[model samples]
Target: MYFERAHISDEELLSFYKQLLYPRMVEEKMLLLLRQGKVSKWFSGIGQEAIAVGATLALDKDEWILPLHRNLGVFTGRKMPLQQLFHQWQGSPLGFSKGRERSFHFGSRQHHICGMISHLGPQLSIADGISLAHKLRKENKVSLAFTGEGGTSEGEFHEALNVAAVWGLPVIFLIENNGYGLSTPVEEQYRCEQLVQRAAGYGMRGMRINGNNLLEVYHAVKEAKGHALNEQQPVLIEAMTFRMRGHEEASGTKYVPPALLEEWAKQDPIRHFEGFLQYLHLLDTEKISEIRNTLKYEIEKDINEALSATSPAVSIADELQDIYAPAPSAVPPPVTTPVAEKRFINAISEGLRQALERYPNLIFMGQDIAAYGGAFKITEGFSDTFGKERIRNTPLCESAIVGAGLGLSIMGYKSMVEMQFGDFVTCGFNQIVNNLAKIHYRWGQNADVVIRLPAGAGVGAGPFHSQSNEAWFTHVPGLKVVYPATPADAKGLLLAAFADPNPVLYFEHKALYRSISGPVPEEWYTIEIGKANIIQSGDDISIITYGSGVHWALEYAQQHPEQSSYILDLRTLQPLDYDAIRTAVAATGKVLILHEDTLTGGLGAEISAWIAEHCFTSLDAPVMRCAGLDTPVPFAAELEKNFLAKTRMHQCIQQLLSY
Candidate 1:
């Protein structure tokens, strides 16, 4: 069923032969470059180039391709300049990734190809998101995502395929079943007879293709593309092929059996295709020789030109500047006028409502976010007002959702995604920390995404439901962490987060969602991220906190007026308001840091370290911390209170005052 004769015209069939030879020849050249130390690494799909060539040919020019490291043929087939590809391998700034990444780990914004991260399975979900975007726009375009047999075992693979199937998105999951995943054989990776059979569980059509047969692969992908575009159906195609070399050049083939290699070499895709073309009278020795010579000359010239180009002389400042989205030149100061009293949840809903009204490109996605209005009703009536396309209810797949949001942001859309519960964010932590956080720095890409995390401990929500994990985000470099305390700040910071160019992790305290109320402006306002707000003025000691900690610190100060304690609410955690901390420490000569997260290795530790380094002489006493105990949150109300530091803020303040 997988094998087929040439279905294309004579001219097209001849061209197909060239496409198969291109990556194979290029891989050979790259291997030599690797030995010469001109290129860093080589992940060659030398014997399996037909799969990429065929798939790329099947997709339309406007369609997107999410390609993996071994899919070099896809890049070349997309007409990506040989010089640029050589430049990428040679580490020249002229490469697609600006030398931020080595080899095929970068993508082209112009061509709609996503340069994949090392995590093999994540790109499938990202492609699903891109396909979702196309579906939302009512475009006929489809997305083609590539992965290896080993990647099919990853949780993201199932998440991506399941979501795509559930939505009936126009996407094709192309799995290169090359028998081995790195050093492990397919026998060890899965128990299934064929990986394509897994699609039945996802309710998607599945096909197995002879990947080494160019015509078979091309026809399979061509049919899949038609299925996706016409029926909005996702199809999983397992291209059975062989890895002619090690996973990478450094990864030797010592583990591969000699007899198996010899057997597969006889079925080498390039050789078989060339022989088939000869049989069809499409080529002879003279024609093949001429083609090889021309391509070799062109490739070598490209290699030489790329080698002559300059590598980027990136400085620490230059690298750091790329760590975040470009800051806005200037933003108007936030409006402090009170329009009406509102709860924190209402403020957040209103903020999102205003954002959807303001930006046409902004989208909201989360589990139960549309008709259900999210788990917290933060988006109640959003689907009715904004339409289901804009207010999307995603499957319970956090990693894919985050990845999809990142993909949308990459395609010039601003996404506001929710975690449902902050603790559930761990499920999507890979996308947050690895892909979303590093895209800008690695490839000069801006994931203008806002991840709304309903975080914090209170209400006896237990360990899984209640975890103040802001410290986890603050530790990552590319992300901006914002934890607003008041209703006004919640609304303002959320707006600011959406406005900011970089990915922002906006931590909306779950406990403060309905518990806090204050006057919030109806007019659109953006609180500058990374700025601190002084809630109360005092002189004896400064209490620095954020989120729920702000209220606790304020209450502590109100109870002990004689202590003259000041309350500083740090709205943003990553780009912390160090200046405010310095001023407070210099004025009070004593500092008390309070937070809902556990004590050890918390943001408090970083704050205390900075104070000791820069504000050592300003301190009249050692910095004190009142933080949650180093243990998982308990279920009972009294145990939860004892587990939190909110109850001990006043005690910590008194101790700092005495010191």
Candidate 2:
């Protein structure tokens, strides 16, 4: 209702002008602040200001927005106090509610504008689920995410859009088609004629508009809102604009060549809009002058005030706050012991299946996870039973599939993410590492994600399909890592993960998925994370193992009955069970740690070090560790077997037994 032809009035045009001028002036002031060392850093949305302000006008205050980097205009359009933004630029806590969140990634959950990210693609996936929540909650708000055309190439983008298109999610995917992506051209980033065109393949509508024309953008976004809310379908809008500046102010455009710069600069939306507004008697020379003068004063005041505001930049303790909302230190929720418990794998499925019953927002998604029962068939019969709404068979873009799951997680959905093969998880590292892991570290947000990777290098999966990458993720903070060795443990560990409030990486070893199936109670139940399960007891030597290594230790104890041995299943790796380990080592006086990862920095090394510290006094000899040789797991069956198997675990224990 703001534009007349677009149903927006002259008053709205002036408002848009005021907003645009305000951000432009802020950029100028901020750049100067940076130069004077008043502001330590800056990223600009210079020429693309009009559409940013325009998109904000189409928003309802209750709606949520997740914007990628270079969305300063959009950030301010939502009325992030200019001074707060300037203070954020100057590294002040006043700009962020959580003292440690990134500057532009500001969040006022009260305002419903979640945050922004420097990483591309994943934010869009999260937007889809947030929008889906609005649809389910019957809220009239839309969830919108904006990104550059360069992001179109990321699998996360494809995954999010495919799900949105299939489910008709009430979301908007906005592409800021600025010609360059860090020196890469749009043509190089994609094969599609227009990025928007790909939406139709996913069963969503697509629209394009003049990125600089505030009126066009406002109207186009307004048109999409009805379908987004009413039909619960997504729409792709490509705002066609050239990057009048480099990717950022500090990004030199020397690669663009001066000729192209002049060409794009001539089409500067501000100058063009000035001509259009003056022609319509909406904005003339005198009004433009007044607006510029007012904006300059406002910009100056915002920078000075923001820079002057006193607040801590960051402190070490803030590192753990928002990862899980830091609930009072209490025991994990008790796993329900159902009266009619079933098999372990099935029990786990039931726990996840029943999770949807507890929280309707919970969704289970993966490739063929529904009727096809997932690639491992772990979710077999879920689609037929839970319906497609809960179970999904996503395309093979692991990046996007996981990214979309992450999207739902951020929106408070209990998303049970499944990757067919453990090794395939490497494909979605961006979503896991950049977006999922950093959501809390970067902005103190609980992404609330649960990713289940069927890991270990056994069963002849070979190099690409059979590698254990747990060590890679153990290095990341703010994520709970678990390796459930048995059926009962799987059911209990998975239930506990769902109940917990942080991002969890559930590594279900493929070798144990069906090979070692056992009875699990029909009753609901959960097992505590960060606690080790004792499989067998002996005092001669203590062997700490997890996943397939647990089985090896058990076999060793059985085969060598004469020598007493104790086995510890380290179910959770991150929050280790040091008490159980120390207790076992004290009783045995010798410790042997084993796992399937490489020898250098595998879980075994850490366990060995722990024993060397706390249980060193009780130890009779130095701790021994056995793991896969530090090399790629080969394809040959016999070599692969010798390569990944802990053939040395039994031998290492024998050596410790001798000690």
Candidate 3:
């Protein structure tokens, strides 16, 4: 018999059959509930249950699994409470996300399961990170991530696979070739004959197996896990299965051929397993009926309990909660005296060095950051001070690295990612805005990651490298935006970012990196985030700005002493210093907001609107904005000078002063 060839005992084979049958029963009941209008939505995993159950059963309890929407067996196989799963599906407060998310889109830290984002590819890189953590801690653990044949078409899929292969991370990438990705057929997805064939290009082991055969799937995954740990490499497995039901209950499968459905129906995993068991005299009609009856009763009981639980209460304050972890109240006071003067770039490097010395779990990742010391030399000599493992030099895969940072944070590690130039962040924008920024709010997982952006213009680096894109991230919730003007604030704010338990986008102007210098403390100190500093106080007009604009405002204030401008540097943009802004507006009747980003959709626009809304009574004149012209930065020196807002700063200040 096939079971004897695989060396499976009667008891073990029976257990596998039971595990597979449980999810099938659960799905059938859930489908009924959907029809009865009890559950909101359901992603049916009717025919693909064997793959999830087999792969999950093969992994150790401690190993992590990132499952997609169709991977309901992963949750059921892990023995997550049926009530909690029902609660999650019903959007009740007792669910893992506290009803913040729907379906399998929430993660359970207690169960070592990370739920997938709608953007499926990012989770693959996140798996790379979880495996990287295992490598760093020297644990013999492997991370398994699931995807569909269609998800392989995404750029993140390629980036994740290439990165995992390069790092030799212990990851198993399972592609359930379920013949369709939300209505699109496998032929439309890729030109390759099989998805596993692409693994050879990545220099990793590839295996293709019949997913409907429970024993074959279980043994393949078990062997893949061993190969990953022993050789410190990733494996890509393509499990051939078919989606017997619609992608979702609402999307009917009229697109599928009737003949194909009939052929696959005869190969139902549960029926096949039961036949095998019957041949061995280990099962009979009575046992099958008993198992179905027991599972149906248990599922109904859990569903009723879940339905009885109340939905989350809706409150104005509750809507704003969980965007970020509670900020630490205790902050080390800054040193009053300066140790020495240093450039902005040097201060950043020094701050990173000290943070690595203090926190053993802190890691730095970027392109050319190790021996090459990064494109901007911010991590020079860091590899020598901290080993290459901690100061990781990554490939040109920004999305994977950022997602990896999220994974590292999930494993209780602090990670800092440097975009060689801030504009390159577009390559990894999905990972930052969707995955990193939303993980905390979705499942109460703290994404303790710092992304250092070398932003701003005026260095003649042209449009691509010199963009003050802080406004893009500032608009996104669950992210702290910091733009430091001086060397002292640069070091202080960076250290503060490391201390904070949220995702921070720290923007360092390229122009200020070498041209700017100031007195910085040698000892480690953290400035409170979301606090604005009044660089120079005045009573006539308020010049509210950040980053490069701070320097311009200071220059204007120094040049025109008679104007008496109160210059306020907004270090943090997300949790903006509203109190300080109110103080500034009260101190000065007239205000002029300035920034390096273009006029439309800039941070200045938001600040201007807020002042108009809240501080309208205190303002003697209209709030004005001085920002870059509405055009892409030019390469020519003469055109660039005209494109910058610094030239318009004098004109804007004069207008506000006169008004």
User: What TM-score, computed on C-alpha atoms, does each candidate reach?
Assistant: 0.96, 0.90, 0.98
CA-lDDT, candidates in order: 0.87, 0.76, 0.90
Number of clashes found in candidate 1? 0
Error of 1 at 520 (Å): 0.8
Query: lDDT per residue, candidate 2, 191-287, as tens digits?
Result: 8788888887888889998887877888888988877877778888999877766565677678887887787777776777777778779887788
- Writing each residue's lDDT as its tens digit, candidate 3 over 391-438 gives 999999899999999989989999999999999999999999998888
C-alpha lDDT of residue 183 in model 2: 87
How would you encode candidate 1's per-residue C-alpha lDDT over 82-199 as one tens digit per residue? 9888888877777887678988888787777887888888889888878888887888888999999999989999999988988889899999999888899989999988899998
Rank the models by TM-score, top first: 3, 1, 2
RMSD of each predicted structure: 1.9, 3.3, 1.4
Relative to the true structure, candidate 3 reaches a TM of 0.98
* Stronger candidate by lDDT (2 vs 3): 3
lDDT of 1: 0.87
Those runs of model 3 whose alpha carbons end farther than 4 Å from true positions after fitting are 1-5, 333-338
TM-score of 1: 0.96
**C-alpha-based local distance difference test score of model 3:** 0.90
